[model samples]
Target: MPHTYLVFVWHMHQPFYKDLATGEYQLPWTRMHALKDYYGMVEMLEEFPSIRQTFNLVPSMMVQIEEYAKGEALDPFLHRALKPAEELTDSEQEFILKYFFQANPSRMVYRYSRYGELYDAWRAAEGNVERLRRSLGAPGMRDLQVLSQLAWFDEIFQENDPEVRQLNEKGRDFTLEDQALMGRKQLEIIGHVLPAYRRMALKGQVELSVTPYYHPILPLLCDSNIALQSHPGVPLPRRFQYPGDARLQVHKALDYAEEKLGFRPQGMWPSEGSVSDEVLALAYDEGVRWMATDNGVLGATLSSLAGVRETYRPYVWKQDGREMRMIFRDHFLSDLIGFVYSRMDARAAAHHFLDRIRENARVLHNEGRDAMVPVILDGENAWEHFDHNGRPFLKELYRLISEDPGLSAVTVSEALERIPATELPRIHPGSWINANYDIWIGAEEDNQAWEYLLDARQTYDRVVNGPEGAALSEAGKAMALEELLIAEGSDWCWWYGPQHHSENRPEFDKLFRDHLAHVYRALELSPPEHLSRTILRIATPAYQQPPSGLISPRIDGEISSYFEWMGSGIYSPDHRQGAMHGRDNAVREVRYGSDGQKLFLRVDLEQQKPGALAGLEVRVIVKSVRHESELHATLLENGAKGTVVRSTRKRTLGAEVSCAYSQIFEMSVDLLSMGGRSAEMIQLQMSLWRDGLPLEAAPAQGWLELVPSEPSDWE
Candidate 1:
């Protein structure tokens, strides 16, 4: 038979979010994903007997999930959500209003009626979380509480489980008893997640793999200097070469997965698919049979082979009496499912994917070689943007795959059993992202984070090797070392650079610094004074870039010209910041600038259908220290017409607000008409709406304020 192997590895991971000093889980992602993706991702595999996939479970995430299953995690969101609505304190109520809606507006929130209603109310209040909390009576609060939790339930449970079905069916006016039941069901569901994956592995429907204990970049652990090989001249921190930590992380991951899943993980997916010769040697020594990385690494390692054929096959690194099999993921195919398919119709998307796969298979067959396609991506974070949490798309894709005789879905090990791996003398030193460690290092924030880690590590060594060493028990030193390992995780730096954004980034900074502090606390010593303050140099105020100079762009709802909006201020929605990492990014950014005559605004959206932008209402609000101005327009299908309105805080602006639509949404209003002429400073905010519900808002925190730079500023 002509073989076409499909290797699917769903990389499941989350950072160690706990602060040992306070025993607090700084974030709730692990628990949230457990309820939403972990079990269901594997559980759905049962429907197709012929398909087998790999699930790469990271140890740090596993530990958190286990704690949540036992109801021992001190997650503020979990505790706050379950508390009776009437018993919530002012702060607690405020927390609920702020964080409960940290979800996708189109899918997660709008999928349910009551949740959408509550969210709409919260949005219309315009930052009045406390007022919204007060306005929502006990019944409304209870409904919000129950629905927030329910919105994250697995697709299978939402449809099949009787208790879950009833609560979802009840939909509104939840009771105290209902909240109690909701709490129990959530734990119960989390408890089943691991065992379900184990069952699938045992039944031969799936294979399980493991990453490092704390999901650190193993190459950097071995030698931070290695980063310079992939990215020369990238500024680095003080040398931090800890091969011992890298060895321990790999060894512990295999042991932990064995203890938790009842079998040793045969394959390894290094954190971020990062690999180097040193890291590979460690994995091979730890008894790992095969490991996987991204296509960029493969391309960089073996520049001789052409693109597609070289990418869709396995390879081996044999050097110095050690051998490790490797698979390079098809980054484009993996990203299509991760970032692109969610915006498409399930059937059309699935068929489009199948067509591409078939073409790849045909190409390989003609070349007298079999195709081995490796698709890998984050299992949890991409789903919220998907329809029904990506279940429909997966089902359709899998069904088409199963019906095709030329395609066969297989695990990494099974694929290795059938296809031979090409040999390579050396491996590249980089990660799955752009084939560089720049995401975790190089940038100012990233370099500072590493320096902090180096300082803490040296302090621990000093405590152990110095005069007070012999008196210290080994357990206490080990405890301190464990905290250091937790701090070494790549996730801390993942949020540090200009690359990503999250509403919970402040909490991440606190948790990382707290871990460093506990390294000393565990050793019975005081943490350094510098460690008391945050390593995050700039506090994130929902991210903004100020305008440089005055501009007079034609309001034609198009780019007009590159120079027309060249110096325009960009007010990107905080929610859209993670587009590169697969988060909900419906609208890309809001471009605004002003001239002597009028202030102009443009809304840029992600790729959409012809009529897709029509229904969305683009609303812009401008406020001076003295007055406010508003512009409202309902985009029509032909990109032709919309209703225009002008209003202010005190009274209507009455001036004509010009609105237009084409490739972008553009509007302009005279400054004098909006009361900005004599004002000290002008503040702008913009939002997107559909069906009376707010889809997204730019400058999610604080206003986009500027002093209205003079036209000569550009000169």
Candidate 2:
């Protein structure tokens, strides 16, 4: 009988967020995610003992979790959350109002009526601190403090823990004891996360794996110039070559995991799934039996598109008498869970996922070969976007797989044991994105960050290995080395590039440099002046051009002619600064214009028809000086045909708008119905919505201004 082995590896990681010198955490993510994600992820698997999987824990994240579990970690975010409402200073109150409601608006905030009410009030105030202060008294502040923490408690804790359940039931008008109890419950959850993984792994329901000690890109650490292999002619930072540090990172990770979990880990995810011949050799030396990276890398290495048959099996890479077995993740399947599935019904998404897997497996089985499908993605970040932190969907998926006799869920190691492997003479040097390191290198900002890291590394070598380091105490030397390792992490460069963004961009910038500064401080040397300044410089914005002339394009959704929208206003999002990872931006650019009587819009997307936009909705909002109106277009596929159904313009306000889809999305609105006469100018914004959740938006910062032309201007 033929079978499809499903290998699900969940990479659990957070950047090293603690400041060594101050003994304070720069961010609360490590603690917050531990409370919300880590414990539940492993504990839930206990329900389906037959479905086994692997969890990759980075050593940096483990240390932070340990500190948090012991109640030894502190930060401004935690302090503010724990403070009594009456004792909160005005600035602290403002900070709470600004940052406390930073959870998923639909899943987390709305789960609690009080938290949702406070969020609505805050939004209604339009971020006016004075207005918020006047509306929300000490009681409101207390409610926010308790509800903010309560929202992050895992589903298991919410259902089983008495204190957490009591807080959830109370809902509003929380007292000081409630806030204190929430804080204590948070620590209790953090304590459970590591133990839960340990317990599961020992029970053989889970396999524990790990990354480098601080999550550095091992290939880059071994040789920075390796990036040039995939991306020639890319501007690189100063040459940084150190294979010794690469070796040390791997060894340290294995040793730490063994010490903490009571058994040595046999597999490695290699931070960011970054690998090269040199990296494989280093891991091989560290006793790593298996590893994983994106299939895109496998495709580039094979110099062909790696189809299901090519990617659904494990491979062995051998060079210089060293070998390591590897599996390439099914990128599309992994991305669906990470980005798309959250907006779908739980049971439907699970069935769709299993169907895709079975279809792929059927292809291999018909070829008389067994199949192994590897699905890998971040375990923490995706949950917030899901209802009930993704429990229902996971439960459905696991349950279906358990019942299906043809399918079996196994860890990477377990699958590798059952399936024979193909041998590759050489492998490509790349990260997950596009089988290239362009996201972490090449870009000006990325190159600059690398240069800064190089400078810090050189300083550490010169001082610690020289006569000056001899005078330093052993404790100081250890502290300096720890700082250097933390600085080497891939996270700083992740934020430096234009590919992704978060509201805490500046904080990431500061923390990266601060770590380097501590390295110099431990050596008793003056830090470089450049360390005080940020690496980010203002670059060209992504949006380009405003409407210059009239456009009356045909509304068949196709770009009928080159000249139809030649002078239309255009807006493009800077991809480097996008908010999420592993998501495709359906809209490439938005062009809008007016032909005296009607306002015209053409959405140029990277894809058309039943591609990325299928089963999604695009919303167009027009905000005039006095009024706001909107139009909705739902994308659907009927059999083999695709069509976009535009709803009757809700909040029409006498506006006659029509939409069509062909090669592009086109819409036109009657100017008279848009309150063009009532306002001198109007602002327009477009957003991609799924399951009523706004996934991504154009302009990102503010609305695009559209000025109504004077009647005589046409002449």
TM-score of each: 0.76, 0.75
- Candidate 1 vs. true structure, TM-score: 0.76
Cα lDDT tens digits, model 2, 490-531, are 998899878888777766877887888788878887555446
In candidate 2, stretches whose alpha carbon ends up further than 4 angstroms from where it belongs are 538-715
**Tens-digit per-residue lDDT, 269-366, candidate 1:** 99999999999988899999899999999889986543678887788899899999999988889999999999999999999987888787777788
- Residue 23 of model 2 has an lDDT of 85
Candidate 2, residue 386: Cα displacement in angstroms equals: 0.9
